[model samples]
Target: MALITRGFGGRRRDDPNLPPGQYRTDDFPVLSAGPTPRISLDDWELAVVTESGERSTWSWAEFTALPADEPTVDIHCVTHWSKFGTRWRGVSLDTLLADVETAAEYVVAHSYGGYTTNIPLEDLLDGQAWVAYEFDGEPLVPAHGGPARLLVPHLYFWKSAKWLRALELRLDDEPGFWETAGYHNYGDPWREQRYQAD
Candidate 1:
């Protein structure tokens, strides 16, 4: 069954991609737990380190110069809003992790704002995730994770960390901000896994 959300200013979309307990919204909402940070391209970099100690870093220009992919994916937020057909262009995690070998089963995504989120490595590889810079064919604005953000569309929006800075592969699971704060560890919206109590 799908929700017919026709009340909030006529947001009547009924897409199957929407998760339960969520309403379809044509508008994008800004949901950040802390004040948004202002990061400059010159000061930004992405560092990827494997559990076995393989280290790689990419400057802003180098990151953008990698092969890019444009993916239009439906985004589901744990806060109960589902936005469909959202578009983004970025370098896939596959491209970044291509030469790196990791036996780690999980990953921790760190943000410039000191926020962190943990995810399974399997969820990020094989074209499942990206470091997106453009949204809707435009340079992503800072407020919405401009310069670059981790785009993990399969999970709740928060897992797609804004202002992404580093990725550390872990052999064991390490809980992140929300995960430690009672949000479900693995936020699969389809299962209505919003809170840990669920």
Candidate 2:
């Protein structure tokens, strides 16, 4: 098990009143991209390529059998509205990173529906990030990025890329779906990179 720091700041359970379930700021615009995309994966279809170009693919059953742990964390979106104390379950990113060797400096997290996000490899291997397959003690729902999702608590929620499918380690920085459309390349929540600035 990887040791993670308890808190880093953003949202807290004691914060002002907010409804349960995931909540984002008006700035995010509800992502009107229509219904969520689905990409089925059997045990043989799951793959992970390390920055060093090593590859490991797992079947659905194999992945599901891996050790999973629950973590309660706060989520902050670049748009606004911090959600606190959300529970998630999945293997820690550190565990996954340990299995692969990477010399890349960054990662492009790809998803179905062509959505993707660029994140630094250092941020992902730092041990706080996770591949969350469950939320609130239950299997994640489709609208909320079911099956699996990336959770990077420190950065803006966009960096948490939902409907997560693959992690492509890159030797250099590359903008992703939203980043290409004017979102900030780094997307720090405290910096508030909700939209493109003049």
Candidate 3:
């Protein structure tokens, strides 16, 4: 649901296409908490670890072999920028978590460079999220979360952790790097849930 905030003003407004306090931008802005980490495809792997300690992993080749989907979604950042019609090719989170057994309701998406973001498990299942390896028809560049990144377009972009490596299932909802630092625990863009207070 798109929201309307009467007094909010900043970026270019596209009321029908953006969340409450966002403006449309054609350029994909790069925002990272730290230096981008360089990772080689040969060493790239995605692991799904359950709360019971069981683990499942997929190498680069194995991961790419799974079914892929091309999704064109509009992404909203907490910083107030919204990019529409962004195209991506990726393996759905459903495919990644299919064979794994878990009753956990939360997950912590871990990245190669120590970045982590907590997300509700429900938000990742079905067709809600992806482990995207391509952006705009090309292999994702490091500055934009190369190799692969979690694509949860429904939420704030930060929940879509870049350089995604592992998903750790949790019985409890734990605050990740940004969540602990003041970002909302569940970043629903339409709600303008950028910070915890929202």
Q: Using lDDT as the measure, which candidate wins?
A: 3
The global Cα lDDT (0 to 1) of model 3 is: 0.94
> Which residue pairs collide in model 1, if any?
none
lDDT of 3 by residue, 1-198 (tens): 989875555333536778888888999999999999999999999999999999999999999999999999999999999999999999999988888889999999999999999999999988999999999899999999989999999999999999999999999999999999999999999999999998
lDDT of each: 0.91, 0.72, 0.94
Candidate 3 residues lying further than 4 Å off, grouped into runs, are 1-14
TM-score of each: 0.92, 0.78, 0.93
lDDT of 1 by residue, 53-79 (tens): 888999998998899999999999988
The ten-residue window of minimal lDDT in model 3 covers 6-15
Overlapping backbone residue pairs in candidate 2 total 3
Query: Which candidate number would show the highest TM-score if scored against the true structure?
Result: 3
lDDT of 2 by residue, 1-198 (tens): 987765533353334433233353433234424578665654224456766677776566777788877888777765456667778998777877676766788889887667889988888876678888888778876677767888998777788877777888879998998888988888666555666682
For model 2, how big is the CA root-mean-square deviation?
A: 9.5
